[model samples]
Target chain A: MLYLIGLGLGDEKDVTLKGLEVIRSCARVYLEAYTSILTVRKETLEEFYGRELILADRETVEQEADEILRDAAVSDVALLVVGDPFGATTHSDLVLRAAKAGIQHHVIHNASIMTAVGCCGLQLYNFGETVSIVFWTDMWKPESFYDKIRRNRLSGMHTLCLLDIKVKEQSIENLMKGKKVFEPPRYMTVNQAVDQLLEIVQNRRELGEELALTENTICVGLARVGASDQKISAGTLQQLSSVDFGGPLHSLAISGCMHPLELDMLKLFAVEPSTFEQINIEDSSTYLS
Target chain B: MLYLIGLGLGDEKDVTLKGLEVIRSCARVYLEAYTSILTVRKETLEEFYGRELILADRETVEQEADEILRDAAVSDVALLVVGDPFGATTHSDLVLRAAKAGIQHHVIHNASIMTAVGCCGLQLYNFGETVSIVFWTDMWKPESFYDKIRRNRLSGMHTLCLLDIKVKEQSIENLMKGKKVFEPPRYMTVNQAVDQLLEIVQNRRELGEELALTENTICVGLARVGASDQKISAGTLQQLSSVDFGGPLHSLAISGCMHPLELDMLKLFAVEPSTFEQINIEDSSTYLS
Candidate 1:
């Protein structure tokens, strides 16, 4: 049997109890190291679960997946992921391979960042399409995510922006020269991500898209979610661009036109809470004021 | 301090290690019972975590929220919800209430059904707007979700359809008559959800909308996700509508035009795997064959 278990977003304790039981029972366990990740280290999980885990980096999975599923054809094996088993594309590939290999499999799900954003005081049902903001480079900065977010905003829906993480990624020059050199792994910070977003907005404006980061466009920034020091701040995109969220694995939410209740909640965290509370949403006058 | 913890999707063991620690330290623990739910029972979690838990039903949350958040001003409290802390709208209300009470709060994220569907061989980044499929009744069946799904499809994006869960809901007549009564909770099955989709497609066909659920429109049906008996099957909607997925908490994925890798994975699970694999997707002749 092949087992796929989710280790939720925070530290060592983020893994489900059932997942730990399976982790302990499996003779060999592999933790998928790429995709999404938990703040805890492998040693922490090892100490609590009382089992040593082999980290399966992107190379291992893309190259050695056959070996990982080979014994599953006979005995039980567990492949643990940092979030829900299917939260990333790599795990899906493993599942497809398991199906092809004809191995019976089970999945133990856990908390992932996808649903955890609701804690930032935004309605889940109100969220539009989710987009991932990747690290911008001098040669390869992409603006596709900006288009999706823009479209979602036009539809009056909340947007959940997943920040990018580069794990064991090779430098462009190293890849072209067929070298084994690696670049430092990077997790996008909320501030850097916002800077890129603002740059995209400015470019779009130059191209006549005409949308800019506005004070009333309400945005929420979360840092080190699921950790003890997880911080959530709500303000405008312009306001958020300057705040130091102070950590890795950050996510941002571009909110939609607010329901009275949602606005009330957001106001509680604003620099000027009273200003938002007095808005008479039923009339256009309040928005103009 | 208030902590919103996601229990993830399966049983009680699905709680992350971090979530468990918070639960252990919380002065008051309330499980939000309205949104999504785990397959495990309260006693099961209590036994594992060694703590008594209070169940916060819908009425208690909406009507007696004061009691739930009362002591957060002085002590640490935890509110648990199935899936992620933000998977539903009700949790947003709870977070706002905590803020209004001057209670500092943190959200511990978890995996939710929203992104977990990425396990079905769909690209997470390609999913567009998500829609909820409610269990339709004679007088209350609404079709607003159809438009949202249509909008997503038009944008060339996959749609994540969240099936409805009705727990502790009161009958319309009981509330009007001021009598205390509640209906047994119901979880919509994959079969029922697909049937509604087909109906909506038929309506669009009559209206001359270029939309329909064809025999070749690929789909994935998942049952009892994160459970030991979890099942995943991929085929056309027509074929999947007849398959017995078994058990509650099933989710469906409506695929868009596929990338080469996605097509390759989908072919592995096709009912007619050989025939599907033989086709050259870029060549019309192969599809015609």
Candidate 2:
């Protein structure tokens, strides 16, 4: 039997009671380490589960998943992910492989940034296709995410911009040199994401393109969600670019039309509640049922 | 402090370890009963948490919410939700009120249907704005959901249709007479949702409107998600309209463009895998990171 468990977005204790029980019973436990990270250390999770964990990076999950599923048919094998087991398509790919290999599998669902973004006051239902905001290199700056956000905005839908996290990634120099050296893990903060978004706005302006998002557009920045010190701040894209939301795993929401209820909830986390009063929030109450 | 904990969509054991601990220590534990439901009885959760659970229906949560948070400033109070705490705006309303009253609050994130829909093989990021499909009445048949799905299809994004569950709702006639009687809880099954969807498609055809979804369009029906007996089936809208997915809490997903990987995963749950071979699945490989 194979159990894909979600540890959720918080510390070790965020694992559901059922997930914990299933993990304890599993013969081999592999923690999917690359996609997302929990606030606690790997050792903390190891101590809580009372099991030595094998870290499964992108290479292990993508290239050597068969090894993880080898004894699953006869023994309990568990793969723990930081968020919901199915949050990333890679895990679904593994499930497809498992099904083809005739290994019975189960997924234990838990919260991911996709839904946990609701903690910042934007309703999950209001969000459109979630877009990933990747860190840009001088040579490889991409702005396709802006187009997605624009599409979502056109439909009056909020866009959840999932910030990038580069773990065990090789630099172009290292990759070409055939060296095994890896860069330190890097997590894009909300400020960095906002900067990239604003940069796109500038580029679009230079190209004489109509903008769906501008520096004045309302945006919410969230960091360390579901944690005790989790921070959420709502402001304009320009304002959020300077606010420091300390820590990793930050996410930003580029809101479209706002429901009065959403506007009310967001005011509680606003950079300046009074400033929101000055901003015209087109009511989307008609859309609410 | 008020602990707004999410009991992930399953039985009582789906509660996170942190949530269970906070719930056990809470002076008063109120389960938000109106929005959604878990598979087990309230007694089951009470016994698991070793605390008496007060069922907070709509009236209690909306009208007497102050009662739930009145003592939170001095004692630990928990308002347990069936899914993630912020899955509904009602919970966010409670949080806003808590903040206004100077009460500290915490949220424990858990899987909601929004993200758990990924189990059907469609990636979460590919999903556009989530839409609620209610049980249509003779006088209140609304086709707005179809428009939302159409917009999603235009953007090549999947649409997650959250089936409505009516609990402790009063009939319009009863309300007109000021009756205290309540109707029996009714949940919208996948079949029922498809019937309404198909009805809309027929209506659009009659009106000579552009159709974004049709009888032959691929859709996935999910029932009892995250449960031991969870069932998933993939078929066309017409095929799924008759496919019985036993019991409540069913969700439907309308496919837009399918990634080759998504197509493979959907085949595992396909009504007829051979049927998918006949469909031209436009590859969405380029959209994936």
| lDDT (Cα atoms) of all candidates against the true structure | 0.75, 0.86
Go through the candidates in order and give each one's DockQ. 0.57, 0.74
In Å, residue B278's CA in model 1 sits off its true spot by: 10
Q: Quality of candidate 1's docking, in CAPRI categories? A: medium
**Predicted complex 2: CAPRI docking category:** medium
Tens-place lDDT digits, model 1, residues B1-289 = 8888877777777777778888999998988877676777788878877898899888888888888888898998888888777674446677777777788777777778887777666777677767788998877767788787667666667777888889977888998988788888888888888888777777778889766344456677877666666777777666677888877788888776567666666665566565455445522221220
lDDT of 2 at A3: 92
lDDT of 2 by residue, A1-289 (tens): 8899999998988999999999888899999998889889899999998888999999998999899999788999999998898874448778988998899889899988788888877788778888898999989999999999998887788998889999998889999999999999999999999999888899899999977888778889999888877899998888998998988889899888778788788888899777577666432321232
Q: All predictions: root-mean-square deviation over Cα? A: 3.9, 2.8
Candidate 2, after superposition: displacement of residue B117 in Å?
0.4
Query: Which residue segments of model 1 deviate by more than 4 Å?
Result: A169-179, A212-216, A268-289, B170-177, B212-216, B263-289
Query: How does residue B160 of candidate 2 score in lDDT?
Result: 93
